[model samples]
Target chain A: MKFTILGTGSATPITERRPSAALLDLGNESILLDCGEGTQFQMLKYKVRFSRIKYILITHLHGDHFFGLIALLNTLNNTGRTEPLVLIGPHGLQDIIGVQLRYSLSFLNYTIDYRTTNPGAFEEVFSNEKISISTIPLKHRIPCTGYLISEKPALRKILAERLPPDFPLPYFKMLKEGLDVEHEGKIYANAEYTLAPASPKKVAYCSDTIFDLGIASYVYQADLLYHESTFTKELSARAQMTFHSTAEQAASIAKAAQVKQLIIGHFSSRYKDTSAFLTEAREIFQNTYLSEEGKTFRV
Target chain B: MKFTILGTGSATPITERRPSAALLDLGNESILLDCGEGTQFQMLKYKVRFSRIKYILITHLHGDHFFGLIALLNTLNNTGRTEPLVLIGPHGLQDIIGVQLRYSLSFLNYTIDYRTTNPGAFEEVFSNEKISISTIPLKHRIPCTGYLISEKPALRKILAERLPPDFPLPYFKMLKEGLDVEHEGKIYANAEYTLAPASPKKVAYCSDTIFDLGIASYVYQADLLYHESTFTKELSARAQMTFHSTAEQAASIAKAAQVKQLIIGHFSSRYKDTSAFLTEAREIFQNTYLSEEGKTFRV
Candidate 1:
């Protein structure tokens, strides 16, 4: 899976920075997270295929988190999109989208299924054959939840050289299932022909949250982790006052979780230069990266 | 007064292009016309001072025309803008803005005074000391109105050499107003001391309208004119079906109005290049230019 950061700016407005938005590409399917204002342009800038965005997860109702939704939906409708979209957010999201559509006389051609997030507890919100996703309860000014996506374990790979050249496809399935295959009256041992599957990859996205130890357990041992670092250590007091995390705080969470790599963003607009953010994060988590717009990272 | 074309793409979403939005800088005021999805980013790209945008005139309720208003308002509020903004558009515009603001839980620090547009006859909508604006009714798929802005006549230039070195600043205003200055019983005639004022400049913005002769009279002899050319002459039939205008049609209107210069944009995304649009427009209107993004045209 690959993750793309569309924007990384926080509450304050600056000419050089755009609001928050991110894209997660999982082969054929794409997911959008926290579409802030001007996200459509960010999508264009990043060459994201809007038509392939089957799932959209909104962290909260704040304008900086979900304001781009209506415009994106309108564009999808106008462009003749027919795919069904799954929207996961707080309870009032549907009402917000519905009222705007009503006033604009917009009747979308696609189906939008809204799934309400549970504010009180962490819960599994979405699951498919290839992936399972759960919510990580996050502390914020409003009801919010971060997402944890775990890719389903891959099937064991076949030792093709050890198998008969003309092995039937049906027998190969039995071998992958760790069973002895009897094909054409020939017994084939499963262990001799199959190798163990690779480990499942885990990606966790945590943003718009204060520094809390409770989140470390949910995002533990993640292959890749994205955490919001809205301020530097110098502004830790301001970060607490605003219910946001500093670079040091986010890096500490990643270190506690033992994440392989951490991507930090959602920077406050006060600092025109962001080198200080990376320097501060690296002190706590060595495998840390600063999120840049349109840059993609593999998990 | 100056106008900048921020975006010109049409209904369908294009990866490299953006939807319709323009910035009209009228001396002390910044007026936006037809703000689509990513107008805020476009404003940033064009270095427009968001705080100075006091007025917004929307041609219609189409998604590509006004979808960005809510986000723009949210950003302005978050940026701590307290200036009252005037929005002139269709009847339902206020509700569209109100619902989004309500759902997002954003109470803007600034006040937005919404005004409704009436089709068919020219009506004066905005008037200040420096400029007066009137709406010119036009034909479109929806209730659309063009805008005609006439800047106040320029003040006479005072000759510094003709005035005493120690002359008070208050008399400069009188000199600019064409008044004779009597200092210590010496009468200074206004005509002998000051040069004649420059001619008043007029700009007519005709957007999302079909080819109609009625608009020519309202925009007669304008210093500059901006007309939407969504198609070329070859696709005139398609333009009519979409209630849009061809480059030739836009030029015809500009030629009929005897406008000094013509700017044509709102090109359909089907054409990868815009040279054809300018070429077609120039055939009919000698002083026609294509409206390019971030490029400013003086009137």
Candidate 2:
């Protein structure tokens, strides 16, 4: 899996950084998270295939998180797209987009399936054969929920080179399912015929939230975790008051959750240079990295 | 008056060009016209003083014309602006922005006064000491209206060097208002003491519209006229079907209106190089120029 950071700034307009948005590519499918203002242009700049985006997960209704959605949908209609798009976000997002479309007298060329997320509890929101998605309820001034995306383990790979010549195709399926097969009184052990499957990979995204210990368990053992570090330790009081987390607080959560890697972003506009955030987060979580726009991280 | 072109592309998303938006600086006051998506960033790139913008005129409710408005207003609120903002647009704009704000549970730090424009008729929409703005009804798929901004004529310039020594302070104000002073039975001619005030400069903007000669009289004699030319003569049929205008058609309107200069923009995304649009427009109007992003035109 690959993850790309499209924006890192919070609500305030910052010239150096854009608002919050991220792209996750899970091989056969792609998901967009938190499409903030100017996100379509960011997608254009990053050369993301607009039509390939099958799902969009919005954390909240703040302008910094979901303002670009309507415009993106308009562009999709203008481009003559016919595929259905799925939108998962908090309540009121549908109304916001609906009002704009109603005013403009525009109808989408493609169908949109909107799913409103519930706050204050964890629940599975979406699932497919390849992946499953659930909510990580977060504490924010408004109703917000983070997303947890996990790729299901693939079937075991058959050792083709070691297989006997003219191996039956039916037996190949049985071996991929880790089942021993007896053909013509000859027993072929599943372990000898197939290699073990790779483990499932999970990624968690937490943003626009305060430092809540309850979130750690929901994202525990995630292969990758993206958390908002809007402020530094010096502004911890302000961060707490604004329902945002500081770098130290994000690192503490990352350490407690035992995440393999942590990426901190959603920086405040007051910060001119973000090296300090990295320096602070690295103190507690050695695998921490600062989220940079247009930079992709491998999971 | 100074006019800045922030974006020039039409409804389609083009990687090389942005959607429609423009900034007009009328000396003491500034007005933003047609704030398309990504306009806030364009303002930041152009170093436009957000505080100086007291008025915003939206041509239509199309996504390409006014999608960035809500985000811009949100950013203004986040920046702690306390000045009232005036928004002039179609009937549904207020509700569109109002719904988004309500859903986000955000209230503006500054008050917004919405003015709805009347379609199919010319009417004055805004007037202040510095300038007066009116609507030029245009033909589009949606209910759209163009804008005509005219800077009020300045006070007559007094010939201070030619004035009599120790001129009465009260008479100075009269001289500035084009009145002569009679001192001790000697008549002082007003023309000798003051120069005539410069003519008020006018600019007209018409975008996302079809070729309609009825709009010519409303924008007649404008110092600068910005018209959408989404296609060339070769694709006039397509332009007509799409409710857009060809470059040659826009030039015809400029010539018919006797405008001093014509700027053709809102080019279709199909055309990669825009030199053809300028070439086509200048064939009928010699003073024609293509509207370029970030470029400023003086009137």
Candidate 3:
């Protein structure tokens, strides 16, 4: 799994940092997370294959998170995209898009499978053969939710070296299923012909949320965890009042979750240099990385 | 008056060309004409002093023409802009932005004085000391209105060298008004001290419109006329079907209106090279110029 950061700025717009947006590419398809204004332009600048995006997941109804949706969707329509797009967001997102499109005098050729996830729940919201998605309830001024995208476990691999040179292809499925296969009156043991698959990967994304230690279990042991660090610890009071998290608080959440790696972004516009956030976050979470625009992180 | 081209593409978003947007600066304040998506980024890219923008005029309800407005206004608010803004557009534009802002949970620090225009009639919508703005009715798929920003006539120039060194200041206003003054029982001819002011300059902007000859009178003798050339003459049929104007048609309108200079833009995304548009437009009007991004035209 590969994660690309499109925008790193918070609600405010700055030239150095864009608003919140990211792309998660998982081989089969990609997912767009929290499209802010200028997301399309950033996607073009970063040379992302935006056409491969099959699902779009939005966290909340904030302008920074949802303003770019109409533009992207309309551009997609104008560009003649026929593949169905699945859009999952808060409850009122569909109606808002409907109104904007109505005013735009538009009719899309591709069908939009609009779905809404309860920001107050932590249940699985989407599932496919390659991955499963669940919501992480977040504490924000508005109804906000993070996403936990977990790659589905692959089938057991066949130890081809152990198999005979002329092994029948029909028995490969049984061996991959970790079962013994008796083909042509000969027994093939599961352990001798098969090996266990690697562990599945999980990426958790959180933005525009206040410091909440109680929800650490929602992102426990994720392969990669991206949390908002809107301010430094010195401005912890301001962060709390604005329903945002400081770098130290995000690092604390990462440490409590015990994730493999932590990426912090959604920086406030007041900060010109982000080195302080990195230094402070790394003090608590040793495996912390700063999310920069156009940078890609691998899991 | 100085005009800066912000975006030049049609509805479709492309790398080489952006959507429709422009800035008209009249020294004291500026006016934004038809803000499209990524307009704020273009403003930043072109180094526009956005704080001085006092009036925002939108042509229609198309997403490309209106999506970036919310982001711009929000950025202004975040940057502590307390000066009120005047927004003039179609009838439903205010409610559309209102719905978007309501969903975004936004409360602006400054007030927005909203006004609507009739796309079927020509009338003045805004007037200030610097300029007067009128709506130019255009034929389009949607109810769209172009803008005619006319610079206010300057005060008559005083030949200060012809006056006495100790001339009283009380008569300056009268001299500027071009009235013969009697100072200390001495006759001072208005013609001897004052010269006629330069004629007022006017700029006409039309986008997403068809080739309508009836509207030529509205932009008659404009200093600069910017009209959309969405297609070449070869695709005049397609342009007619889409309710857009071709380069030749725009040139025809410019020639018919007797405008001083014509600027054509809003090229269709199908063509990457825009020299063809310039070549065809110049065939009919020799004084035509291509509206390129970041380029400024002064009148």
Candidate 4:
């Protein structure tokens, strides 16, 4: 699994930084999280293909979190995308988009499947054969939820090179399921021809949330985690008042959750230098790293 | 008067070209016309001080014509601008912005003076000491109007070199207004001391309007005129159906109005090359020029 940070800045628009947006590439699918005002431009700049994104997860109704959605949807329709796209967000999202589209007299050329998320509690929202995604209830100024995406366990690997020519394909399925195969009185044990598949990688995204230990269990033991750190420890009161988290608070949550790696971003524009954030986060969580725009990390 | 083309592309959003937006700089004041999506970023990129922009004239309700207004206003408020902004557009414009802001729970820190324009009629809406702005009726898919910005007659010129040493400063105002000065038995004639002021320039902005001869009277003898040419002559029928104009039609309007110079833009994104637009427009009007982004033309 790969995660690309498209933008890491907060509500304020700036030349050097953009608002919140991220891309998750989970081999079989691509998911966009929190598309801000210029997320489409950022995607174009990063060479992120628009058609590849199958799902969009919005955290809240704030303009900085979801303002670019309409433009992105319009561009997708203009580019002739017929693929069914799924949008999972809090209640009122569909109405917001519907009103704007109606006001502009825009008719989408493509289909959009929208799923309203439950904003009050953590629940499993989406799942497919390859991955399972759930939400973590987060405390924010508005109704919001964080996402937890986990890659499902892979099937047993098959050794095609060692197999005889023109082997029955039905036998391969049995072997992949870790079962013994019998073809024309030839019995093949699964252990003799197949190797165990690698363990599934898990990633949890906890963005735009305050420091709350109550939800740590949902993100515990994650292979990789992204959390918002909008300010430094010096502004803890401000962070609490704004329903945001400081670097130290985010790192403390990561340490308590025992996550393998922590990626922190969503910095306030008041901060010109972010090295202090890194230094502060690293004090509590040694595996903490700053999420820079256009930077990608593999899990 | 100076006009800066921020964006000129039509309908579709493009990486190389933007939609429709223009900045009219009238020395002390700046007026934004037709703010397309991402226009605020364009303004920031071009070093346009948002604080100086007191008036915003929206031509139509099309997404490309006014999508950026709310975001720009939000940014302005976030930047702590308390100056009242004047937004002039159709009737529904205020409600569109009001609903969006209410949904997002965003209240502007500054005041916005809303001015709704009447469709399908020429009306003088704004006037000050230096300029008078009137709306010219135009045909479009929605209620739309073009703007005729006329600079008021120049004040009397001040001759600094002709002023006597230690001349009374209060007499300077009378001299600038072309009044004769009578002080200490000295008869200072207005004609002998000062030269004539330069002629005031007039510019007409025709944004997202269909081909119509009625606009000629409003734009007659304009120093500079900007007209939307969404397509060339070959697609004239399609342009009409979409309530748009062709390059030839725009040129014809300029020719009929006897405008000093015609600036044509808002080209359809289907054509990669824009040379055909200039070639076709110039065939009907010799003083036609294509609008290019970031280019400033003095009138």
The top-ranked prediction according to DockQ is 2
In candidate 2, which residue ranges exceed 4 Å CA deviation?
A160-174, A181-188, B160-189
Better of 1 and 4 by TM-score: 1
How close is every model to the real structure, measured as TM-score? Answer: 0.87, 0.95, 0.92, 0.86
- What lDDT, from 0 to 1, does candidate 3 have? 0.90
Off by over 4 Å in 4: A159-194, B128-130, B152-200, B232-241, B271-273
- lDDT, candidate 3, residue A298? 93
Arranged by DockQ, best first: 2, 3, 1, 4
Candidate 2, residues B142-185: lDDT per residue as tens digits? 99999999888878888889877877788878888888888767
Model 1, B262-284: lDDT tens digits are: 99988887989999998889899
Return the clash pairs for model 3, or none. none
Model 2 DockQ class: medium
lDDT per residue as tens, model 3, B1-299: 89999999988777788888999998878999988887887898888987999999999988878889888988888779999999999887877778767866778899999989898889999987878999999999889999999988888899999999989997888999878899878999999999999899999999879999876899999999999999999999999999999999999999999999999999988998999999999999999999899999988
Tens digits of per-residue lDDT for model 1, A1-299: 89999988987657777778888899899889889877887887778988889999998887778877888888788778999998998878898788667755668999998899997678999998888878999998888889988888877789999987898988887877778888888788888888989788888888789889788899999998899999999999999998999999999999999999999999998988899999999999999999999999988
Q: Higher-lDDT candidate among 2 and 3? A: 2
Q: Looking at model 1, give its docking quality level.
A: acceptable
CA deviation > 4 Å runs, candidate 1: A158-193, B13-16, B119-121, B152-199
Second chain TM-score per prediction? 0.91, 0.96, 0.96, 0.91
